[model samples]
Target: MTSASAFWIAAVRARETGRGAPLFIDPFAHDLAGDYGYATMAASERVAGGENAFIPVRVRWFDDLTMTSAAAGVRQIVLLGAGLDTRAYRLDLPADADWYEVDRREIFQHKEPVLAEHSPRCQRHIVIADLGGDWAEPLLHAGLDPAARTLWLAEGLFFYLTEPMIVDLLHTAAALCGPASIVAADIIGTAGLDAAAMRGYRDWCDRNGVPPPFGADDPAALLHAGGWRAEHITTPGAADANYGRLPIQPGGRQPGRTHLVTASLATS
Candidate 1:
């Protein structure tokens, strides 16, 4: 499976278990992924699975983070690299809030039939543009009010971009945000990259026909340099603690290093 295939597999798993008094429920995810042909690709890999421990952990962390920000009155959610993610469908949110999902035109186009089949539970908008191209403009055009405080989620995406691209992305996000905006992203630190975990990550990428694009050894410095405040930074241990989940053991943790970061735009 490629990176794309891995994501679909994860979505299928989420959809299957999400309805069963699920730890979480994303009723629309599996069906949409299936409509888009990911289900067929994922089927062959399904039988080999034990529990995908990391997916559940990450999902719970994001669930908690989104709820926390919503409680603080966030009215907008921007999901960058929003591939097959079910947050907008599953998370409880205020009625007036808006959710914007950004991704490449090809990917979003692939999702249109799926979207038509299952409308999001919330006000949802899709911005189809390549992140390496003109994504920011399309997001603005999609009714993303930059003046409004928003929670931006860059989950499972940063590693697919180069460091310079990541820097530019943060800078662009900062410029678009109001003072109260917050960003939650996942990362893989240098230490983790150097550990045995890196081997597993490389193998996975190889199996999936993708290459690791980039990584940040220091997320704090990266965000700080891009003009955002590091409100909260956490290792897998810290994230697991916050969500009452267990950290991945030994090589089970994705190698090539990883961490999750939550940052906020500070008041000037």
Candidate 2:
């Protein structure tokens, strides 16, 4: 399966290149996304009815969370399914910390050349592994210390995974992360996956040869079952998540809700 990283990079480019002050700027996004990525994003937007602020808002939220975690002295940051993410270059991460970007081989092949001239602020390691398989092995082999406090980010990743896969991934992450580690992710509710309001999105994925997206109706409960203590759970249009770009009230819940979550590994 082709990694959809490029298309996401295109979305970042669109947001960063906009007129208004953007939430974050990804300077490398332009070269990483290229023409094909932009075309794919445009096609998806058309298929989904219109461009939405979900992607950009989530991007900003994750950026903020990463910065906060880094500042809190959590030195090991792992971006699972890292995609064409340019956080290491864009964010002012801790210089003493190690940033791990884990994804399949092809993603790096496409990313390396464009970022060859650019230098990351922190120690960045590229880990080659498919999330569906034994990714923990490669990640550990890449020098991820199990005893270090880690910030695990699975942004825009859980939706593509099956429920069982999600559980397994969380379990693996919990096993590897040291005490007091943080895990942040985004997940669509079952309503968003199956409700008529999201039918267009489902259809668009099908047309693009991507697997049907998965969702959890109760994201907090799902995280709890997977040995995590959900600290915060909020939808995309909520005040903290939305930067005045979403078309809703500060705390309004839109149709097809996508929940952004922050959790800590359970001690038990």
Q: Give the Cα lDDT of each candidate.
A: 0.69, 0.82
Q: Model 2: which residue pairs collide?
A: none
**lDDT: worst 10-residue window of model 2:** 247-256
Model 2 residue 97 lDDT score: 82
Top model number, TM-score: 2
lDDT per residue as tens, model 2, 145-233: 99999999999888888888888889999999899998999987777676554566567678987678888767777787778888887
Tens digit of lDDT per residue, candidate 1, span 204-260?
Answer: 767877666457766777787777777776666453423444553332223344667
* Candidate 2 Cα outliers beyond 4 Å, as residue runs: 195-211, 248-256
lDDT, candidate 2, at 104: 88
Consecutive 10-residue window with the lowest summed lDDT within model 1: 248-257
What's every prediction's RMSD, in angstroms?
4.6, 2.6
